[model samples]
Target: MKEDINNDRILLERLKNGDISCFEILYSKYSGKLYNYVLNISKGDFYLAEEIVQNVFVRIWEIHRHIETEGSFGSFVYTVGKNMFLNVIKNRMQEYLYHDYIIEHASELDNTVEKEVEYKMLEEQINKLIEQLPPARRKVYILSRVKHLPNKEIAALLDISENTVESQLTKATRFMRENLSPYCEIIALGLFQFYVS
Candidate 1:
């Protein structure tokens, strides 16, 4: 264990110096263990586990210069991986809950002509933004959000992996959010009206 710690310190030092070989070495040492750790937490969801592991390593690589070599890199890896998984779970749950809320309370929304016009305008703006996405991403976004398809269904329908579907949805939604956030109220109204309609 002491030898392993020394090796990790040396590897981390090289990693900080932009050594891809040392980075690969560290990845090899921890990826399987991290995958298993994440796998158990995901309740055997292989795709989520794989996604979390890859994201954790990518994040580590992104901020390698500031990594603390004297500390336990294993613990760091697990901590980062766990946090990433939790964030993914949190985001998924929020989306699911938001969808459920729209379904359950959609009819309760005020049905005024002014509100209908506002929702239509916002919906048109959102549609225009979505049209700016790359073709594959646009298709995925439409299938997932507009058509109310699940990731697995979208993947099967498009002959792509769930990871691809998830990635496309992430990028698509991020693009939408960045472009439309200033009109957040209108967008919310659009989404609520969209579902209710």
Candidate 2:
């Protein structure tokens, strides 16, 4: 076990320095064990198992520079795989819950008129929140978020630095998030559409 740890530490250093052979060696050493581990936990979902293993390796490569040389690399890899799996599960649950909520709410609304009214109310609430921001912060928030402009673009449009644009947007978002905690799910659903598009 001690020798194995030392060997892994050396390999990790080489991998961090961009050695493809070291990456291949590391993959070969761990991929089978990781795959079978994920496969068992995933309850025989072969495709998902394969994807998780691949993602683990990809993540390792991406964060090679940050990899610790004093600990078990296998543990780090397993932690990454576990986190990925949990994220997938969390996202799926959120989707299921969102659909369930929408279905329940849709039944209550029943008609297009009610739906329109509800939508208008939500939009007005969103606008009201935006209106509460300080004037400069509101402009930055609107340009960066509502108008879907990049920070650089927002800065150029407002004749400010990109850092200023980012700072103001961050403050605006923090304020909104703090005040709108109750509406987080609705806000996430609304913004997620924009993010995906």
Q: Please, what are the lDDT tens digits per residue for candidate 2 over residues 1-197? A: 34543498889888878987788888988999888888888888889889989988986786576566777888877766776676567567767886886787776546767555655666777688889989999988886666555564465456678999888878888877676667555555443333222
For candidate 1, write residues 1-197 as lDDT tens digits.
Answer: 34644488888998989988888888989999999999998999999989888987887787687677777889989977886776578568767876786687778655657667877777788889988999999999887677555575466557788999989888888888787767677656436334212
TM-score of 2: 0.59
User: How many clashes show up in model 1?
Assistant: 0
Number of the top candidate by TM-score? 2
* Backbone Cα, N, C clashes tallied per candidate: 0, 0
Q: Which candidate is the best by lDDT?
A: 1
Q: After superposition, which runs of candidate 1 have C-alpha atoms over 4 Å from their true positions?
A: 1-6, 108-197
In model 1, state the lDDT of residue 24. Answer: 89
lDDT of 2: 0.72
Pairs clashing within candidate 1: none
Candidates' C-alpha lDDT: 0.77, 0.72
Give the lowest summed-lDDT range of ten residues in model 1.
Answer: 188-197
